[model samples]
Target: MNKLYQSYLGSFTGLRKEIWLLSLITLINRAGTMVIPFLSLYLTKSLDFSLEQVGWILSFFGLGSVTGSWIGGWLTDKIGHYRTMAISLIGSSLFFVLLQVPDTFWTICLGIYLVMCVADMFRPAVFVAISAYSKPQNRTRSVTLIRLAINLGFSAGPAVGGLIIAHIGYGGLFWVDGITCLIAGLLLLKLLHPKKSVEEVEAPITSSQSAFSDRSYLLFIFTMILFGFIFVQYFSTMPLFYAEVHQLDEFHIGLLMGLNGLIIFLFEMPLIKYLENTKLSALMNVILGFLLCGISFLLLNLTGWIGILIVGMLFLTIGEMIAFPFSNTFALSRSDGKKKGSYMALYSIAFSISHIFGHNSGMHLIGNFGFAFTWYIMLGLAIIGILLLLILRKKLEKETIEISR
Candidate 1:
């Protein structure tokens, strides 16, 4: 037990104190993440929205996210990460509160889109902050630590949010989520004071390179978009499928969803530590992650048993753990300090636009063919993502070797 404790402690030894505090902030913020998880249920049951309506409304949210990420990256480069993050967090909180206003369908839909746009602007800023604060050697673990904090908060949120929705209602969920975001923004202000002048963290041939002109980064983004298309279905469609097919209640569904967070919180740090110390490359980890995620969905078709759902969630959780952190490190490794924010913002579009392709398509598929067909389609996409990621990895490796020479 003593040796085991030491090993775990050692894994996180060299990470900066600022990163730890950032992780704490993420944990607090995500703990209140009650809105999105239950949004589908609220729309269908409470608003009496058709599947098509729900799909379009959610796709609008993604549209807003796409705009937000672009603006956030540009802001991070111009104004600096600290200010960008602060504004995004505080602005998003206000929007969440406004979202609770009683309104018509078009009004509510517009509100949802605006809320996501303000909130998602924080994504690129956070990535820039993480890269600025971390050592290149420790970058992967640093990113993983942030994710671990998010999952820890997520583990608590859904389970508690489930209870809140069941007893207090969806309005309560929005209010609590807003309050938490405000508090997190305040904490960021207190803890992290940005340097007056952004320090150049890495030297590059040119700081003026546009991400639009970078062919390698573009290919990587394309690969990420494919992966994102498969992954976002967990948020967009999986909850609906569970409710419809499995007949699970809100609390039970929350418990199952929370299970994904719990698994990541418990295992991701140590797993990343072990892998980083091995010969396994980021690209290979990505390939395996995609394969596992695909298989998780495929498992759904194989069993109607609830027991299989846990196994499936386990695979999905592990896949997220491996793919997401490494993907961040890989992108950062390819970028220099000057272009980091731009690179991260572009990277974020993979997830932002995926909300459209993944959710809208999944909903359409389920509406017509049923849940089995949706999983089958996701499985096929994951396989394609794996191949694309593999090719990207090889090209990236070649580029790095040439740069070294």
Candidate 2:
């Protein structure tokens, strides 16, 4: 009993100062992002844009992200995390407010697209900062804190946005998001400045794809692409599955998202603590997350009840808990030297590619295959991912041992 109690306490108690700072960083950054949930709604309802135009605008967002991350990673290698992040935050905020400016279709698309890219730049810079801040020993803990902060921000955003929109209007959401970004950017610069300064100035972060000849890094990136493809269904496909096939309402849909965040917030610490020592094992966790995600679609088809959605969400959330921190830790471990910035950028590249494939494939699958068939197809994808990941088990174990040395 004492052991159990100690274990529980130990999970949250031993976090490093860096983890705390990163958590606050994420919370503040996400706090500023009231634009996410209401983005599509605002475009359609308030801006008088059609669904087709909204889709085009959203694609620009992704395109901007791809460009932003790629460029940001390069800049991080040349400059450093603190400066890169500060620039990204300040620059992105300017772009966010540009969304509210009335203009031609292409003009609005270009503006919003740039804002997305600025946001994307923050992704690798944030991860690379964590890698630089903590040694390999506690990298997973650092990442878990960031992930938790993002979810916390998500849970907080809707409630706040809903109330704010009630008073300020939808256009106000973009302006507020911009203001928060500016504030958060200043905070991040303050938070990430290294305490013990070496006399020699540090070189910036970098990521040359040709240099990624480190097979482990490449493999990890590839696997993440697959996992991301499967994981993205939560935001995209899951809602349609719930509403169209199961005949559920918006209330249940919102509740399911809330429950997923709550579950992750409550349990992510314990889960990451348990898995902190098991880096290579994260491959299996990611595979399992995909399987759960796959089966979640299947369950929705099988069980018509709203409770089934909760169950499916629980499975996906658990999978996320297991997979992400480990994957993050592994990615950073490879690029631990002077080239860490570039290395982290390579990791971001996988996610960008995965976003394109996942969103396109999800729509295609659900459209033609029908709901249940899509789930079955996703199940097959997960199983194949597991098999592919097993091939890397030996290499990952060796990597972990080397990091310890």
Candidate 3:
């Protein structure tokens, strides 16, 4: 038992101090991520918006995210990751605060779009920063560590946000979210100065191809967009499912959502460690992750029992744990020094695109066909994603062989 405990602890060793600090910043930023999780609910219940209105608002959020990601990548490549990240953090905080003022449908939609545009700029920049900070071999673990921080923060965020909403109101959530982002941004500036923290580690140059020109990578990105389309339902639609279908309150829904983060926080690192030791390729692991995600949604259809929510959440959490870090690693590996931000930006953009379509489509599906049909649709999308990933793997293999010759 002692040996097992030590082995689990050992998984986190050898990561750089900068990576840890970055994770800390991410934790702070994501800990206040109360808004996104409850946005649909806020629109539907608080503002009394129609489901269609809510869907359109969320799509605007995605549009802003897409804009932010593109700009962030451009800034990272032109200016640097440090400045890009700082700007994103501080700039987005102000917009988040502005979100509190907008009560009408169009106003709320515009507000969300602006906030996400500034907020999501942080995504590509952070990915570039992670690549710069970590050793090549340890990249996956480094990404996992960051994800751990995110999930850990998310574990606390929802429960607290739920309580705040219950007692104080949605206004309080915006204040808290904005404050945290400001704090994180300032903390980042103070601690990780550009000269000291943004040091790039030595890594072999694999490909200098622009992300735009990489056909296989583009296919991979498309697959990820599909995956994001399906996976994002957790944040956008699943909360509504809990409220309407299971008749859960905000607090109970928060607890269940928090459970997903808690599970990932506890198990993901050790699971990642175990996977890293195996001969399985990253793409294969991603495919496996997709399979689990599909099964998770399918599990919801199998039973009306509330316990199945927990069970399905477990599957989804595990799938997320497997998919995200490896995807980061794969994307990072495909680029070299100057192109890193562009590659990661496109990667971020894929999800941003997913958000535009995923949330609105999901809400429409639920409103029209019902949650069971939505879950089945999600499962079908996941299957399609898996098939696309498999094709990408084959193309990647062919490219590798040709390169070797």
Candidate 4:
């Protein structure tokens, strides 16, 4: 048992202090992430919006995410990741508070769009920061460390958020979210001093090619969009499922949602370290991850028992653990120094685009057909994503062989 504990601890060794600081910042920011998880619920219950209307508002959120990612990427390259991240954190915090001012439908939609525009700018900048802070050999582990912080914060956020909502109401969520963002920004400024921390480590530039010109990478992005589309349902529609179908309340729903993050926080880093040592290709791991996610949804369809929800969440969490870090490493591997920001931006944009359709479409499917049908659709989409990834793997291998010749 002692040896096992030590082995697990070994996985986190050798990561730079800056990476740890960055992870701390992410934890602070995400721990207050009470709003997004509960956005659909607030819209439906508090404001009494229809699911369809909620879907449209979420789509606007996605649109803003796409815009933010583009601008963030551009700024990261232009002004550097430090400035970009600082601007995003401080700017988005103000917007989060402003979002509560708009109560009506159109105003709410516009509010969400604007909030996400400034908020999501943090994504690409952070990725660049991670790359700058870690060496190539340990990069994936660094990413996992950051993810662990994210999931840990997520685990705490929802449980606390549910309590906040129960006692004070959804209004409290926005204030907390905004305050946390402000704190994270200030912490970043103080702890991660730009002159000392920025550009500490430099990844090698293998190619000068633009991310848009990379066909195989584009295919990989498409696969990520599909995976994200299915995976994001956990946050959006799955909560509604718990409420309407399983008859769970907000507190229990928060507990269940928090389960995904808690599981990831406990197991993901060691799992990723284990996978990194194996001969399995990153793409192959990603394909397996997709399959597990699909099966997770299929498990939901297989039974009406509440235990099945936990079982399904376990599957989804494990799939997330396996897929996300490796996919991030793969994207970084394809990038060169000059366009690293652009490549990571495109990657962030893929998930952002998925948010646009994933939430709305799932809500529409559930509203029209029902949850069972939505699960089946999610499974089918995951299958399609797996197949696309398989194709991408073959193409990547062919390109490698041709280059060797």
Which pairs of residues collide in model 1?
Answer: none
Tens digits of per-residue lDDT, candidate 1, 130-243, equal: 887887788899999999999998888999999998899888999998999999999999987786323355444376777878887898788788788888888778998888
lDDT tens readout by residue for model 2, 1-405: 999878867877655576587678778878768776555556655777754566566556557777887888988777877678888889878888887885667987788667878888888888877766654556787688788888877666656676677777877778888988888888877765655322122333344444378886687678777777777667656656666777754445545665666777778988888765565365666666656666665666676676887888887788787778777776765564447667778788777666556655666676677767777777777776777677777777887799899
Scored by CA lDDT, what does every candidate get? Answer: 0.86, 0.71, 0.91, 0.92
Structural similarity to truth (TM-score) of each candidate: 0.96, 0.84, 0.98, 0.98
Candidates sorted by lDDT, best first:
4, 3, 1, 2
Q: What lDDT would candidate 4 get against the real structure?
A: 0.92
Ten contiguous residues minimizing lDDT sum, candidate 4: 197-206
Give stretches of model 4 more than 4 Å off: 197-207
Off by over 4 Å in 1: 196-199, 202-205, 397-405
Per-residue alpha-carbon lDDT of candidate 3 for residues 1-405, written as tens digits (9 for 90 to 100)? 999999989999999888999999999999998988999999999999999888999999899999999999999988989999999999988888889998888888889989988999999999988888888888899999999999999999999999999999999999999999999999999887677553355754455678999888899999899989988999999999999999999999999999988988888999999999999999999998999999999999999999999999999999999999998889988776547888999999999999999999999999999999999999999999999999988898898899999
Candidate 2 stretches with Cα past 4 Å from truth are 1-6, 38-56, 102-105, 162-169, 196-211, 242-252, 277-280, 364-370, 394-405
Residues 369-391 of candidate 4: C-alpha lDDT, one tens digit per residue = 99999999999999999999998
lDDT at 323 for candidate 1?
Answer: 92
Model 3 ranges with Cα > 4 A deviation: 197-201, 204-208
Query: Any idea what lDDT model 2 has?
Result: 0.71
Per-candidate alpha-carbon RMSD to the true structure: 1.7, 4.1, 1.3, 1.2
